[model samples]
Target chain A: MKRNNDNIKYDSKVISIRNLKKAFDDFEVLKGVDVDLYQGENLVVLGRSGTGKSVLIKIISGLLRADEGTVNVLGQEITNITIKNLDRLRLKIGFSFQNSALYDSMTVKENLEFPLRRHVKNLSTKEVNQNIEMILEAVGLSQAINQMPSELSGGQRKRIGIARTLILKPEIMLYDEPTAGLDPITCIDINNLINEVQERFHTSAIIITHDLTCAKATGDRVVMLLDGRFKYEGTFEDVFKQTDDEMVQRFHDYNFIE
Target chain B: MKEKTKSKFFLSKKIDKVFIKLNDIWLFVFRFFKEVFVPPYEFKEIVNQCFELGVRSLPLISLTGFIIGIVFTNQSRPSLESFGATSWLPALMSIAIIRAMAPLVTALIASGRVASKIGAEIGSMKVSEQIEALEVSAINPFKYLVVSRIVATTLMVPALTLYTALVALLGAFVNVYQFEGTSFTSFFVQVFEAITFLDVFSSVIKSFIFGFTIGVVGCYKGYTSSRGTEGVGKAANTSVVTAMFLIFIEELLSLQIINALRIVD
Candidate 1:
């Protein structure tokens, strides 16, 4: 399942976080974390639940601001930027939430169109329709376009959620547990979709998951987060096999069982 | 001394919670005002919410208004009869409905329906990360969700209040005709003569405040909801209760302001 990233281009750093520190009161979720996400590469941030995987991505996307350190996302330090300015920067970053986070009030088509209509306000009706149609087809959920989020299954919802983000045509995608709560087949399908998204769109992504299979399938380069810092960094096999630490092995085995 | 200190400590904790809540509300309202006038106004969303909060609540408002009017008319008949003021029935009822009962009834009903609906809807959206989804999309969730609902309620309450005044008048007329054989035109003529422009204006202004109160309380509760799924239920419950509580406070304040303004006039 390890897709070769030998040919994947890394023209520039899409995201570079140096000494990123975020905490909730005394709980230091991400402490002095440093990471880089390069262009046209699917960088998987692997960690167990509550291991700051989601928090890292949230900071990258500016959903949650880092308490300390510089998070340079697409060349802007998010911590120093105002919300109005950050929103402009956020249009370039697509964040798919752990629960898919589709607007329950809206149908799938509306959910997809939500981002498009907001960011690209001047698109013609024809162009809007084309974009919706194209993105829905890309996610392979064109049939479920009119259905509400509640009507779709977990996998379908995740697909539509990715489609919604894709409609914005972001330069970077941040998938937060895109395969968190799905069956093995659905997980594989999501993993394949993540890879296809990179291949087709030629976009950089930071896929956060504890699922080893997902990381191997989607990630071009993998990093394992332990104690709020990456303990292993390399290809999935290199990181997993090259590590001699018992904690890293235990985490890997634990992740495999889960 | 120890018991007194403990009591004081608990009291201080309660006060601290209130102060923190007040600060949050101040910021929330501040943000609401800031976003409301900003560009990219969600007019379509505001209109849709108005349709949902306004047009959808009309039948219920009308029914409640009518029943209130009939019951009030029946209850006041004996008192007026004893005083030889039975002829003043239409005028008295119209005055009371326009001034007090109509807006109060409409807002109370809406607090149950609209406030709880807004609370639960937004609370669920918050828990489900739909609000964050909008934020990540560069669409302001506060502007789209909170402002739109607030604008809808602010507008719809007054409109519903106006409609209730008319419906309640009709109900009062039906009762008057059934009991005392008054004609439709006669009852309306008496009602209209008794209701001044100030009465109409005050009712409208009061309803607007009631609507705003309901909207703000509902949005505040729902937006700041915690405890996940359980939070959503608590949000709906608290929204209804808080909105109703604030509505009464607003009603009293509006009444006092109106009385002061009348004296000035």
Candidate 2:
């Protein structure tokens, strides 16, 4: 597997996870995993199902505590930070869940409005509406402003989820399986959207996905997580060249077959 | 010897599980109180929850109250008539309804309806990672979701109980007029004479306690739910069961305290 060469230099580290370990019951999900996220880079963590990709991002976000090791997000050690500080840090990080996770009781407009109203309390109705309009237009779902999550299709729901997270203009974005369970065309659309978001917002992101196409489209660096630690870290082209590795070969063969 | 060891191990595991659950719920309660008093109170959410808990529950509460009143009067009438104490019907029925039946019945209904609703809603959110989404968005789910529902239930349950008592008394009036041709005015007077400030106060207190219990248990079950969709269903079911159990326990304790206080007086 390819590794990061010493020739490259990152501008500044936005997130640094060192010797992270997490276990539920007797099952260890992350075993001394370490990674660094630099500014304005999309670091795609590509792993097969059940590889604890989501767990790693959750630990970085401070949603789940690590049993061992330290996670520094925006230069703040998340493990020891107070809840108030964690919350302030969270306001700068947006998470787009795989299932969209929209409030089922609310309309699309209300779902988009929720974060703004909570964090940016002084925003007036007109400003909020304009913000919502801009995001909905960016996601190309301005027509669905009044619709409920249940009424929307899978692709629409994913777009709305992205829109909701982007409304706050978070400095860091964590997307958990952004294109999972979608048709090939829809998957491409979501991948393109991810690229567009990266360019538009200039936000560093950690995208957890098994889709190689997504990694190629959005990742400046693709890291393959295997056995609870990163086994490969390089460009998407470097990943394609590592066909001698069994797991990487298998992933390429399976994904490239179509 | 091996069998005995196995049994002991299982017993200890069960005990550990119960204690862990107790500790989790206790911590949840403390966190709720702490967050409730913090700044940025969610008045809009609370108002919305109140409307849902109080206004939407009116029909069911009214129906249960009326039926309970009629059934209770019918059941108690022959016994009173046998003792030639038919004239004491309104007083006895009012005392029973105000002191125990109304609060207990209303709480049970609220537990079934509101607790299950809260549990299912929050559990589904937990399953779908919406709670985590809120956390990531800098929104305090406990304050926005749990506290609002708890406060709403606390305020609305007593209001519902009062309405239930009134409907029950009206139902009792219907039964009384049908049997003895007694005027509504006399039945009202009799009921008012029997119901003291203590009865009203105790019923309100019990309802408040029941409401708080329902809110807390429901939110706890939902917030901690695991195993995905099936866990949501389990959370809803367990919420109703636990809320009902707690309501009965609260009622029993309140009754004992009221009796002890009366004896002292």
Candidate 3:
């Protein structure tokens, strides 16, 4: 596997998880999982449905606390930090949920401007409008600025979700199933956009998805989560070569190569 | 023996459930106070909620108040005439409308309208993960969603009650003129004589308490909503029911306080 060393430096761990475990009621979702993310690297977590991929990201972002062990994000342990400090740390991390989760009450412009107006106060109207235009342009949705989330198509909503997160200029990005319910073409478009975002912003990202196209298109390294832990870790080529595990082999076989 | 054990288990479970609910509401109220006084007040959301809870509710409350005044006056007229105290009609009607009917009716109406709406909106937001989105953005969802809503209801309910009182008195005047040929001037004179500072103050205080109850209960139900789309409906239903119950409890307490203070005859 070829490593991109351009943005790497000493102390390259942007996020580190050690023996993380989480359970909902009696169901154990994550049982002693461990992972690390380096600076400016796109790490894709591949898992089937209900394998705790989204849970892992939520734990890292402090949206959900782990049952045991530790999650270190940006050199701060998130498991035991105060809510005020967690909120402060959250500003540096942008999370795009699976459903795009746009504020249905607001127009696209308002939704995109929400984070900017909240975090960066005293910004002039001109600056706010400029930032909104720039981010919408990046996502190719400048025309839909005045539209509401309900008015947008599924793919458009996803792009708008990505645009809203990107407007914050976060150092770390966590995308949970960014292309879960889109057409193949739209999925490809989103995958390409993900790669472009990583390259342009130099952000370290952890993309949680089961889509092989997305993983191949954007991931520098891939990890397959199974039975509450990372069962496989390698490049896309290395993962495809593994046939010993039935689940991993099924994932490989299910992908329609173009 | 098995039946006895089962009954005991059920009773304990019921008690535990009630205590859990009380604890949840208490914590929700604490969080509201803590977040409401903090910085970054959501002024725009508060204004929006005021518009929704106050302005939008005017027509329904006005109609309800008018009907209540007409019915109440018509019902009380025969009894007063039997005692040769027909002149006391306006005063009795005014006191009833101002002290109890206006606040209780307006609160129940708002509990059905505003409380249900807040519960459903917030519950749907939770179901769709919009609340989580707000949290991930580092914005305080409780302050933005709950505090502004509670503050708006707390302020607007009294305003609505005052408006209801005016409309109800007007209805009473119309009803009186139809039956007894009492002039508007005489009727209003009797009403003004009957009303006191204590009556208005007590009514306003009760409305404020009822409004706070509706807001807090609605927000609590919605904030803790789970189980997907079905949960949204359940939250809306439970919010209205719980808020109306609390309004009655507040009314009872207010009456006791008024009697203690000799504010009512």
Candidate 3 lDDT over residue span B1-265, tens digit each: 0111232454579797898778888999998988888888899989999999899999999899999999999999999999988778999999999999999999999999999999999999999999999999998899999999999999999999999999999999989999889999999999989998889999999898999998998898899999999999999999999999989988999899998887435
Ranking by DockQ: 2, 1, 3
Q: For residues A1-258, what per-residue lDDT tens digits would candidate 1 score against the true structure?
A: 345566566678888889988887667888789888888889999887888998898888777878788889888888889988899988888899899999888899888777777778789988998999999888888899789999999999999989988888889999999998899999989988898888777789999988888888888889989898887899888998997889778867876543
Native contacts recovered, each model: 0.61, 0.65, 0.51
lDDT of 2 at A35: 93
Q: B139 in model 2: Cα distance from truth in Å?
A: 1.0
What digit string (tens of lDDT, one per residue) describes model 1 on residues B80-167?
Answer: 9999999999999999999999999999999999999999999999999988888888888899999999999999999999999899
RMSD of 1: 3.9
Winner on TM-score (1 vs 3): 1
Question: Compared with the true structure, what per-residue lDDT tens digits does model 2 show for residues A128-225?
Answer: 99999999999889999999999999999999999999998988999999999899889889988887787777788999999887887778899999
Candidate 3 chain B: 10-residue stretch with minimal lDDT: B1-10
Give candidate 2's whole-model lDDT: 0.89
lDDT value, residue A256 of candidate 1: 59
Between prediction 1 and prediction 2, which has the larger TM-score? 1
TM-score against native, each model: 0.95, 0.93, 0.93
Residue A5 alpha-carbon offset, candidate 3, angstroms: 8.6
Leading candidate by TM-score: 1
TM-score of chain A of each: 0.95, 0.94, 0.95
- Tell me model 3's lDDT, rounded to 2 decimals: 0.90
